[model samples]
Target: MPKLKVIAFDGTEFDLEAESGSTVMENAIKNAVPGIEAECGGACACATCHVYVDPAWSEKVGQPDVMEEDMLDFAYETKPNSRLSCQIKMSDELDGLIVRVPEQQA
Candidate 1:
């Protein structure tokens, strides 16, 4: 399993062991990470699962798909590094990934 580290702007953080097939959002929701509401339950509808990937991990995770990209536009704080967590599938390569929840999401 890969390790995931999700941090919030307020200094709250959750680390969980994740499997390759699970989505980042799933891990967060399962662990009760505050920022990811996942209101749409992994569907690419709600932008409530918005997250900001650390710039260092940006290239490793890549960009959100068209649907996710569109949803991200509605997120609280838009940025080049912003991504909908539902779109990020965990993998060995992404172990130790660090994403930050926005202040609002915190």
Candidate 2:
């Protein structure tokens, strides 16, 4: 399992042990982390699961794909580091991944 840290808008931090191959959004939802809505499940159809990938992990986590980049147009306050949580699959290389929830979803 990989460890994940989700920082909420109100400053809540959710530390989770995530299963490999599952998504960051999945862990957040399963752990009841306060901020990931995952409205479209893991379909990559909505921006409700938006988050900011921590600067430290940005290079490894990488950028969103073309389809995801389009969907991010609807996310609130997107930045250079913005990513749809549902698109971030877990793996040992990504252990200790950190992300911050936006103030609100799209």
- TM-score, every prediction: 0.94, 0.98
- Report clashes for each candidate as comma-separated counts: 0, 0
Clashing pairs in 2: none
Task: Compute the lDDT of residue 69 as modeled in candidate 2.
Answer: 99
- For model 2, the run of ten residues with the poorest summed lDDT: 33-42
Q: What lDDT score goes with residue 105 in model 1?
A: 41
Model 1 steric clash pairs: none
Model 1 C-alpha lDDT per residue in residues 17-64, reported as the tens digit of each score: 999989989999899888688888988888888888999999999987
Could you list the CA RMSD of all candidates, in the order they appear?
1.5, 0.6
In model 2, state the lDDT of residue 14.
92
Q: Candidate 2: which stretches are off by over 4 Å?
A: none
Q: So what's the TM-score on candidate 2? A: 0.98
